[model samples]
Target: MKNLLAKKDGELLVSRIYQSESTQFEVKSCLIGGEQVMVIAGPCAVESEELLKETAFKVRAAGAAMLRGGAFKPRTSPYSFQGLGEKGLKLLARVGEDMNMPVISEIMDSEDIGLLADYADILQVGARNMQNFALLRKLGQLNKPVVLKRGMSASIEEWLLAAEYILAGGNSQVILCERGVRSSEPWTRNTLDLSAVALVKELSHLPVMVDPSHATGVRSLVSPMARAAIAAGADALMVEVHPQPEKALSDGDQSLTPRGFSTMMRELEPVARALGRRLR
Candidate 1:
């Protein structure tokens, strides 16, 4: 009788067993879309008419290439704030039309695809849903671009496979996002995996971005990490900004004030220039 199994004691292996050739994929540059990097910035969620419009205008004026905000938030606690639902999506869509910038927001379920597709120019599949194969399959069927994040507890290979799910589904316009991952240390909300930023560019044909805001879960850390992400070869940056972080309805602690965001953009400009990339 053959012993069918040996004890494997470590991380759960969810990665597809294939080493992608470096040339097999290439990041589709947003520069081709009229910018060197695609800056997706907005509030954590769209709370109201005034707040949403205010943040949208400010970020656009500050040179963001794209806009983002969560209309359907996926919080840890059921009692915690969820989102504005389809109404929020409509607000984001209206902002896109009014401001002339592409809108990006999270899609929590497969069922919301049609409703959300009508609103968002780019659909964001958050870190929590990175490996939600069913959701990935649905997003892949859409025609819009996807901003896929690395799972909170997923490995590098697992992350890429998630991206592969979208690519394999016949949608090639995918963007990779490294938004940190859970670690034993609690100094920061999650350990920022800057190495994954480098590795993704090395391994795949997708444009990679980083979210320093969620990575640290603190306003102070956003700038430094954002600068580091650019130097580490990130194709774009996704930041959360609010006019008044202290009063924001969600994620205020991690939200950068408009003043802070302007400063971060200034510092990031030089790094982008050094990398032969332009800033809008």
Candidate 2:
């Protein structure tokens, strides 16, 4: 079979790839693969109503195009704070509605698809479930856009093939996210592969975004990696921002403080402009 995501003499081989269009589509007003470098920022998990709301407002104010929070977190440890479930989803939706920004949340199971679709503008499939064929096929049937994260150990071809699962199921609104992958490196949380950003753009017509926060567990590395992702040709960025990183219930070490997020946004503007993309 021929490669579905390929280009021949500057022409895309597949028209079904959503980002192949000259004009990009909007996910509830936030445009992807457009001239603007879309930014989605929020806490890694929804710990409390007050914290979530505050983080949402802060990220929105800092020029993020959308808000992201985990209602059902998939932690490695059973003792870890495993999100607030439905209540957290409700809070995320309310905060987004109140702030007038699109909201994103992860959906772990097929059963929660309906509930998550109702609350989230974009349904995310975490890295752990990247190759969850059943879940990906189900998400493909949903009307909402899906942000498919690269698996911790998945290769570029494997990642695109996983995306094919969703596209083959008939849903074309799929956004690819590179959140780094597990590696032998001990310094950082994950070894961020920025090359994937450029390679994906060349191979596929899908809008690709990077998760610098998850890519590097160190909060200090988020800004530089985010800049590098954009410079390497990323369509958007999903950063974990919190009012108080130290107090955040999950991934606190990698989460950026409100002030830190603001500074990064400001610094990102020139970089985006240099690449002929606007930073909204």
Candidate 3:
């Protein structure tokens, strides 16, 4: 793979100049950036304690290495569900602990860092907050790992530099996520940008994961893109898996039901094997 670093961009801390070797670190017993691709799956938002537990159990049983749920959602409309807030975080942590799985949740405000850090094993910097320097700096100060998602309109170079903010803050445990970028096409929610998966793998040593659920925003396409992501050199995948998606509170159309996620996992196994990697 070619390491395509722009002439003027190599000075950033996230650039490959500082670290040529891949970043492999243990997060809740799973080695990210390693040969074993990890699968992090769960509902888009934590609806209820009972529902969260059911979905968490299902995704874990289907081979998800980590549990993901949104406690504080950044919705386009104020009238929509904003998430369960601290209640959701509590449920995610409670269920994850009971199941012995790591939990991941998004952090919107810098003030919520301690609150989220107390529950979420990994603090996710959503696409909207990709360039939130204040929040990024706060995450940098913490020892926790942060999953920095690419902004909907941010360039790959800009995205890497955003990760640089966290790295420069003295926290090296940062994971990059490509959750699709804004595009004019109407069929898909956003372009998945599979090339970025390969590019980031070469441009930086940090592990890159793709969010097919948000990328395609369609249940039928999530599985297909997930397999393609692994083939394109993605280190892991973040999928939205819900129980009875039709009745879900958020992103029901794009969320995969438990059965669909199971079938997707079955399809992903061979593709991962083809690359000499196993989904953890």
Off by over 4 Å in 3: 1-10
lDDT of 2 by residue, 144-168 (tens): 7899999999998889888878877
Q: Candidate 3 clashing pairs?
A: none
Model 2 TM-score (2 dp): 0.93
> Between candidates 1 and 2, which one is better according to TM-score?
2
Give the per-residue lDDT digits (tens) of candidate 1, residues 35-86. 3666778999998878988888888888886778889999998887799999
Give every collision pair in model 2: none
TM-scores of the candidates are 0.88, 0.93, 0.96
Q: After superposition, how far is residue 276 of candidate 3 from its true place, in Å?
A: 0.5
Give the per-residue Cα lDDT of candidate 3 at 131. 92
Ranking by lDDT: 3, 2, 1
Better model by lDDT: candidate 1 vs candidate 2: 2
Candidate 2 lDDT at 233 equals: 88
Candidate 2, residue 243: lDDT: 83
As a whole number from 0 to 100, the lDDT of residue 249 in candidate 3 is 81
Stretches of candidate 2 above 4 Å error? Answer: 1-23
- Stronger candidate by lDDT (1 vs 3): 3
